[model samples]
Structure formats: structure tokens, C-alpha cells
Target: MHEMSVALSVVDHVEQAVRPDGAHGVRRVHVEIGELAGVVPDALAFCFELACSGTVLEGAELVTRFLPGRASCAPCGRTWDTGMPPDMTCAACRGGATELLSGRELRITEVHWSAEPAAPDPGPAPHPEESR
Candidate 1:
């Protein structure tokens, strides 16, 4: 499935973004998917687990936000939700003219890194400290 490739690409990007900043692992990743993007969320989730088997994001949670398909109805003078198959006509007015506004998005928004506990600072030694 194409989901496998998509998941692999996402993992690759997350690793690249985190590895350079002393980050060893990723905790969560936020991905935005649209109804018209033609991506199956279930398939993508399955693929993500398989693709991340040996990657740094192996245990990272794949958080997805689904956006509704929306189109602008010129006759209605407003933007409204259009059912899948992208109904070309406005539901309210039943007009043939309409403008597609969104519902074709597929993007990786951000990645959250696992928080690392701060290292404890050593206290002052018994000997006098040098007054540099």
C-alpha cells in the first residue's frame, strides 16, 4: 500500500529533525490528513508501526487530525462541507458552480521529543573555590 511509503517518509523526516539536536528519541508526531487526500488512516497506522520497527521513532505515537472536505458555494455565498466524491453542486442551492476550498491536505505538522530529566548540578566542594 502507498501508506507504507508515506509512513516511512514521515519517520525519516522525524528522525532527521530530532537527531541533530541531541534528541535520542521521539515521543509523538502530529500529522494532518484530509478526507480528499486519499489516505486511509487505518492503513497508515499499520504501516507506521511496521516502518518504524528499526527507526528512532519506533515507539512514537502517530497522531492524525482529519480535516473535513469543504467547498465554497458561490450561489449560497458561503463555504460549506461537501460530502466525499466532492459533490460539485452546492447542497443548499443545488447549483452547479462551486469552488473547492480545502480537504486535500497531507502534512506533518510537528514532532514532540521525549523529555529528558535534567542532570543534577554538583554542589560546592569543601576546598575553597578559585576566585578567577
Candidate 2:
């Protein structure tokens, strides 16, 4: 499925972004996907796991947020939600000409890194006089 390719791309991108900063691994990845993007969230998640094998993103959580499909009618200047199998025709004016405002998008919005914890701060060295 195309989801596999998409997942691989996500892993590559996450690695590219975090590796430069010395990040040890990725904990989570937040992605925005439109309803009309033609991607199945479950499939993407499964593919993500496969793609991440042997990579820093292995076992990383994939969080997906769905965006509604919206369209604007050119004739009536009206906007409405065009659910799956989007109806491009304007509902208000029954106009055939319309422009898609949103949806059909797949993108990575955020990445949480699994970084190493900082070492505890050591107290100042003991004074020589105190040691004596």
C-alpha cells in the first residue's frame, strides 16, 4: 500500500530532523491528515511500525489528526464540508464550479524526542580548608 511509502518517508524525515541534534530516538510523531488525502490512518500506523524497524523511530508512536474536507463555491462564495467522496458541487447554489479549501493533505506537524536525561549537577568542590 501507499501507506508503506508514506510511513517510510515520515521515518526518513524524522531521522533527518532529529539526528542532526543528537537525538537518541523518537517518542512520538504527530501528523495531520485530511479526510480526502486517500490515506487510511490505521494502515499508515501499521506501515509506520514496519518502516521504523532498525531505525531510531522504532517503537515510536504515530499520532494522526484528521482534517475535514472543505470546499468553496465559486458562484455563490459559499463554503461547506464535503465529506468523504467529496461532493465538489456547491450545496447552496448547486454550482458545479468549486475550489477545495482544505483536506487532501498529509504532513508531519510535531515530533517528540526520546532524549537522554541530563546528568545530576554536582555540588561545588569541597574547600581545602574545610577538608582539613
Candidate 3:
């Protein structure tokens, strides 16, 4: 399924974002999924775990935030939860919708990572004469 590909892409994005900070591992990856985004959360979560195997994100948690579909009516400037169309009319005035304000998002919102281990400090080298 496409969820596997999406999961892989998420890993790529997470790596790109955390690599500069020398992050050793990912703790969690948060994402917002809209009702109209056409993605199955369960499948995506399952695929994410598979995609992250052997990577920095291995065993990382996937936090999903589900958003309800919403549409705004142009005639009356009203908004309501339409739940992904086929019934997107404004509840306030029963008018047609002009724009969709939200519920189409499918992107990573945050990435929590573990700090990389600090480099060990080396003591002063022994003197050349002491190297006998």
C-alpha cells in the first residue's frame, strides 16, 4: 500500500531534520491526518514501524492526530464540520461551501529525538620520553 511509501518518506524527512543536530535516535514522530487526506491511520502506523526498522527511528512511536473535515460557506460566512464532503453544505444557512478551511492535511508535525552521546574527552598524551 501507499502507506509504506509514506512511512519511508516520513523517515527521510525525520532524518533530514535531525541529522544536523546529531540526534542518535527518534523517540516519536507526530503527524496530523485529516479526514479527507485519504489515508488509513492503522495501515500507516503499521507501515511506519516496518519502514523504520534498522534506522534511527527504529522502535519510535508514531503519534497521529486526526482532524475532522471542515468547510466554510461563502454565502453566509459560516463554517461547520462536513466530514469529507457529499454533505458539505453549511449548517448555519444550508448554503454552499466556497472554501475548505482544513481537513486535508497529511504531514509530519513534530519529531522527538534522543540526544547523541557526547564525545569522550581525551586526557593529555604521554610525553615522548615516557613512551619507552
Candidate 4:
């Protein structure tokens, strides 16, 4: 699945950024996906989890934000938000010769992590009669 590939890339990038201390782990990954990027969020999340399993990024969350598309019409010389429309027509003059503004990005924006030590477990509680 393409999600698997995307996840791999994400992990690679995060690894480069995180420096991985003894107790540190990737906590979250923020991603920005364009509406026209054709990536299924759920599928990507599923693949990401599978890819990160047993790795330093294990249990980390994947946060995604969708960016809408934009367009500029050549005929009317107007710019507008295409909203990733099916035909990508210019809303201003209904022109087809419009330049796409965005909606073709799949990038990791930021990464969050935690390096806290694991808490120690307390001894079991004493039974009613065991404690004097």
C-alpha cells in the first residue's frame, strides 16, 4: 500500500530529527496533506502503526491537517480557492486554463516526543490482617 511507503518516509525523517536519547521516544508526528494528494488518512494511519511497531516511534500518534487547493485563472486574471474541485475550473470566470496553487503536498510538519523515565512500580498493598 502507498500508506506503507508514506509511513516509511515519515519514520525516516523523524529518526533524523529525534536524536533518540536513552529514555526518549517519539510522541507525535504532525503531517500536512493536501486535499488532492489522494492519500487516505485512515489507511496511512494504519500503515504508520504497522511500520512503527517495535521501533522507536512505537505508540506515537500521527496528526494530520488537510490543506485545500487553490487556483489562479489566466483568462480572468483572478485567483480563488479551488477546493480541490473535480474539474479544477476557475470560479471567477469559469476558465479551464488555471494554474494550480497547491494540493500536492505530503510532508511532516513537526514532531513531538517525550524523554521521561519510566515510573517505578510500588510494592503490593498489605492485606487487612498482614499489616500490624
lDDT winner: 2
TM-score of each: 0.77, 0.82, 0.79, 0.76
Clashing pairs in 4: none
Better model by lDDT: candidate 1 vs candidate 3: 3
Minimal lDDT window, size 10, model 4: 114-123
- Stretches of candidate 1 above 4 Å error? 18-20, 115-132
lDDT of 3 by residue, 11-103 (tens): 998877735465788888999999888889999999998898878888789999999888788989877776755357677787664688888
Give the alpha-carbon lDDT of every model. Answer: 0.80, 0.88, 0.83, 0.80
Best by TM-score: 2
Ranking by TM-score: 2, 3, 1, 4
Expressed as tens digits, the lDDT of each residue in 48-68 for candidate 4 is 988887677888899999887
Q: Which is better, 2 or 4, measured by TM-score?
A: 2
The model with the greater lDDT, 2 or 3, is 2
What tens-digit string does per-residue lDDT give for candidate 2 at 1-132? 999999999999987883536678788899999999999999999999889877888778899999999999987899999998998998788889999999989999998887753233475999999998
Cα displacement (angstroms), candidate 3, residue 11, comes to: 0.8
Q: Is candidate 1 or candidate 4 better by TM-score?
A: 1
On residues 71-127, what C-alpha lDDT tens digit does candidate 1 reach at each position?
987877767777688776877788878887889888999887765522333667666
Off by over 4 Å in 4: 18-23, 83-85, 117-132
Q: 34 in model 4: Cα distance from truth in Å? A: 0.5
